[model samples]
Target: MSPAFRLGGLELQRFARARLTRAALVAVVLIPLLYSGLYLWSFWNPQGNIGNIPVALVVLDDGDLGRELADNLIDRQIFAWKETDPADAEKGVQEGTYYGSLTIPADFTANLKSPSKDGPPQPAYLQVHVDQGKSYLFETIAKAVFAEVQATVGKSAISDYLDRIFVSFGKLHDSTLKAARGADQLADGAGDARSGAGRLQDGLGTARQGTAKLSDGLRTAGTGASTLAQGLGSAKKGADDLLSGAYKLHRGAGTLTQGLVTAKDGTSKLAAGAVKLDQGAAKLAAGNAEAFQQVDRFRPVINQLADQAVPFLRSHTGDIRQLAEFVNVAASFLADCLADLPARIQADRVKADKAYKALKTYLDTHPDLDPQLRTLLEAAEKAAKRLAELADWLDALVGEHLADLKQLERDALGVARLARQLANLAPRLAGLIDQARDKFNELDNGLAKLADGAAKLHQGTGEAVKGATKLDAGMTKLVDGASKLDTGLGALVAGANKLDIGLGKLTGGANKLNAGLGQLGQGAGSLDSG
Candidate 1:
């Protein structure tokens, strides 16, 4: 302790001896207090330093928004705001009277509120002019306060923009919702329209098929009409020929009637003369020979007439049979054509209706089809309906003609049977005529033999009387045969006249049928075109 004390005392005395060292030590101790006091004296409280900053406010903007910002900056007490004009504010900053100056542009509010995504490039700013002559701390603090106020105004402007944007977005949302609803309605309408269009298309398809069928029917009808026209023409010509033949037959019948009367008179005279021959033997031989010659000559004429009549009847029978067969075949074909037409039309209509329903359902689900397409679809629907109607009408027409066709078929069958019977009887009638001719020849030969017997038996009167009686019986038979021939000829002429009248009616009916077919064809063509 003694040694340390002695060293400490010596060090103290040495420190005291060096005045400059002693002064330096005292200065070091006091300098800290001075520095602390100087700094602390200027800032007695933290709150006092806030408004102590001298800042100039150059209110260049005359609007309320800028004026409000100025008031807010001053109210914050961050700076000692000195309201001044722009010239004074700039002079104050340059003269170091202000730490910084804030200048608000005249169009501050307008600039602040103008919103752009790219940039509010020339944004409403607090134009700050900092005094370089001020302390770095003062300048830094002033600039920081200015930056905070600028940010505050910027935040306010951005907030206002955001509020307006939100409001606009709200209105847009309502408008968009309404537009969406309208679009939905439009889509629904379009769907309905598309469905209609599909239905129309299906109808059109059905119509097309119907028209095609109608066209085919028209063609067949036309062909049938043409054939009928030809048949009518042929029938007319045949009727004319028949009428002429009937007239000729009537004339021939009249001639045959006169000849029959003459033959009958001659036969009666021969019979009387034969009776007289019994009384006069020489006269009986002459009369028997003359009667034989007359009989032989009449036989040849009868054979010729029979041959002609048989051939003519056969030819007419064949023609009638052919006509009947043709009519029967054609009627059957026509019946087949009409039989299924109504069913086919109904089936097609059902298919078209089904297609329309399916298409309508599809369109209901998807309503965004083009408007022009919808219109076309509607038109198609109408066309299909019309086609269906046309088909129905055509079916009705066919039905109307069906009964007539059936009647025709019945008539044809009758004609065919009648023709067949006539055809069969024609040959037999000719054979009967040949038998009659042979009988006549035998009679002639017997008369000649009797005449020879009469001449030889001039002395035997009883045998001559028997021969005369046989000759008189033969003459009576000849008169009866001639009368029958005249009656048959008259009947033939009457039958021919009836046939001509029937053929004339048939031709007229055929002409009417042809006209009806033509009209039907025209209607079919019109329907097809439509």
Candidate 2:
């Protein structure tokens, strides 16, 4: 410490004596201080230096999209913006009047607005012209800032395009939901139609079976009527023979009475003639009694038919009528639905086609779209076209089948009417048979009285002749009643024949209804799947 202090004092005394050395040391110290002070003064407020970094902003876009990008760069305040045309900006950058220039192209908006899915998107670039001869800090800062601005602008444009596309997608989703709801409604309607058709088919099946039974019963009744008519004809002929025999007997009685007064020798011949006439009357009475018994046998058959027919009508007719009414109502509803289906389908087809066409136009205009997005759009367009075709086909199918449903409804009403007629006919036939039985019993009693009177002719031959006259009148009345019965049976047979034909038509209509329902089910399924 002592040696170092002695050296420092000797050096200071030497430096103080020498003016050139002292001047040189003072100059050295002052030069460093002046240099450091000048640097500190120049760089003290670095933020204020931004105004000195002059940069040219050249906007060449035709629209606001480019102008917006230029404005954003200017507002960042990283550089001083110089108002310049494209040519002036290029010249300023090269001549060192501007550190750098950013020029936006004329087609910037058009390029930035386009979105593509098949390949890389077409990019709109911000042209950066930097003066390489300018200060390193100015050139580097301008480049870095412009690069960031370009990236930000590009991102903003892409975000805007993506937002617009997503809006269109949202609208498409809403339309798809509407279409789906329509399909669900159609499916519900079809399901209801299928259920109604199934019920109608079952009702028709029962009616068809009932009609077949009725036909068989009518045929049996026709056969029985024919048999009864033949028996009545035979009885009428027998009555004519009896009446003729009775007239002959009356003449014989007169002859016998006249002979009793004229000659006693003619008494044996008259008595023999009276006895023979009485024996013939007895034979006639026995034949008439057998014919009456045969006619009476039809009464139980008619009663049984009435019993069967009446209850069948009462139990089944109400149900049949109700089923027919239900079928008619269902058919009317189906007709209404089908009537509008073609028009609705046509409208749907038009909408689908319009949407598909729009998508196709967008795809045509945007060739450089992303591949995945392009594929999705293409698929959507194709699906829309297919839906249009399916809707058209469904429309045509409804138009073709509506008539069959109407016919089915008409046939159901006809069956209901026939059932009512059959109910009325049953009671009327039963009454007619009862009347015939009563008439035959009266004829049998008249024949018995004639036989009794003929046996007592020996006591009163004139009374026997009077009874024969009354018996002939009764035979005439019986023949007339039998002819009326034949007429009624012929009318019944004709009515049955008409009913058979109507039932056949009804069966055909039921089959058509089933077929039409099947077609409707298929159309509903197609709509749902699409």
Candidate 3:
């Protein structure tokens, strides 16, 4: 026997003596056996559902959007929902009755349309709270499942919108087709009406009779027209004579006008030139006279100005720098004198007063008639009083020094600062000098290269300028040639006009023959009428 089985058998035997122990052992074995049997029964005859999983569903919203969404979840058969208040669902999750709770806020619909970055919409946020210590993994699965459901719902909403838009688009298409057919029908009806109108116009006998009367009038008109044609023929002959004369006169008049315009342009240019020459001569004369006058007048005035300026510059010359230097030196001396004096004087006065009090106390305390001691005591008293007086004098000196020292210290510091400034400026000046040296080197190199490059550029530019000059001359020649061509074309047009006038005479003769034929016909008709 295996050790494990033997051990288990011993454990079973140990408790076999007591009836209750024996029954419990049997129950332990039989419980598994009963469970196996029940499991087999379940396998053979399966139930589609488990007991309603204690799933809490909470909708914080009262709106139709939340209601519809929650109902969809129920319809999907994901779970048997334990409809509960939001707070109670949390409690149930703690109690282990519910696997998890789903909460929807009041603005769930609005959030579906316009959601925050972290929540809802594509990511499909649902507040799913579970007792993580017990059912955290299940809650995670539920979140994933719900996420898929949300995507499906979003797609469904889109499909609904597409369906509605498609339906509307179909109706619009039909309406448009109907309208187009109606317009076609209207066009056909207009064609039919047009055909009817043509027949009506043709069948009107009164209108035809009126047209026949117009034809009779036209026949009468033909007699008068023949006479008019003869008169027009004579007029055309006269016009041709007049036009031929005008052609000759117009050619002479155009030449005269061209000469006149040229003369006027030349006269205008000559007048402008004369005016320019007169103005130049007047200006030259005035300029020379003014120059001479200015030279004579300015000499004395300049000398006087120099004399006056020399005295003025000399007058203030020493005062500015000398006074500033003197003041600066004096200020430095005063500052050195007053450095520690004010603090010393005040302290000394205080000490002297203290000394006086001490000496008086000693004198009052001792009444011994030792003259040396008494004299020594009196001397100390006088010395203390004198020190006090000295202190006052020192204090007065301190006040004077304080005033002078301020200006003096300022001047000394300014001088010292100037020295330091000069020290600071030395390195900057050196840097500037270095920069200048570099710039000079660059300038030399650049100028040498520039001179070489400029030589080449200048040669190229000269060649280009020469080419341009040639092109300009060629353009001028082309313009002159074009002007000559225009003149030739004008002459050709005049010759062509002469031919047209000759042809017009022939046409007039033909017109005369046609008029005579018309007259003969008219006379025949008149004879018939008689």
Report every candidate's CA lDDT: 0.59, 0.55, 0.54
**Any residue pairs clashing in model 2, and if so which?**
116-368, 116-369, 116-370, 117-369, 117-370, 117-371, 118-369, 118-370, 118-371
lDDT of 1 at 494: 47
The Cα error of candidate 3 at residue 115, in Å, is 7.0
Top model by TM-score, which number? 1
Q: Order of all candidates by lDDT, from best down to worst?
A: 1, 2, 3
lDDT of 2 by residue, 1-530 (tens): 69999987786686667664466455544554554454455345644576668888888787778777667667676678876896687557545688666666565676556443322233444555554333334334554554557455555644464322200000001223334455555545554543344344346556556655655555555555555545554554554345335433433433343333344334434555656676676666566566556655665675566667555655565565656566556655565665566578778878987988899999999999999999999999899888878877776776687576456545555554555554455445445545655665676666666655544553364455455545545544544444343344333333332332233223323333444445554554443343
| TM-score, cand. 3 | 0.22
Model 2 CA deviation exceeding 4 Å by range: 1-45, 49-52, 74-79, 132-136, 147-530
Residue 523 C-alpha lDDT in model 3? 57
Which predicted model would earn the best lDDT? 1
lDDT tens readout by residue for model 1, 1-530: 69999987786676668664466456545554554554455345534565777888878675677777777777676678899986687557545687666676565665445433322122343445554323334434544664667555555534453222210000001233334455555545654553344244347667767877877887787788778768866875776577456545544544554555566566667656655655687677778878877887787787787678666645575564556566556655555655555577667767666656655665566678788987777667666666666766766775687677566656655655655565455546555656776787788788879878877766466465666667657756765665566456546644554554345445434555666677876787786676
* C-alpha root-mean-square deviation, each candidate: 66.7, 69.3, 48.0
Q: Write the per-residue lDDT of candidate 3 for residues 230-263, one digit (tens) a residue.
A: 6665665665455445434444444444444455
Tell me the lDDT of model 2 at 292.
Answer: 54
- Distance (Å) between predicted and true CA of 89, model 3? 1.5
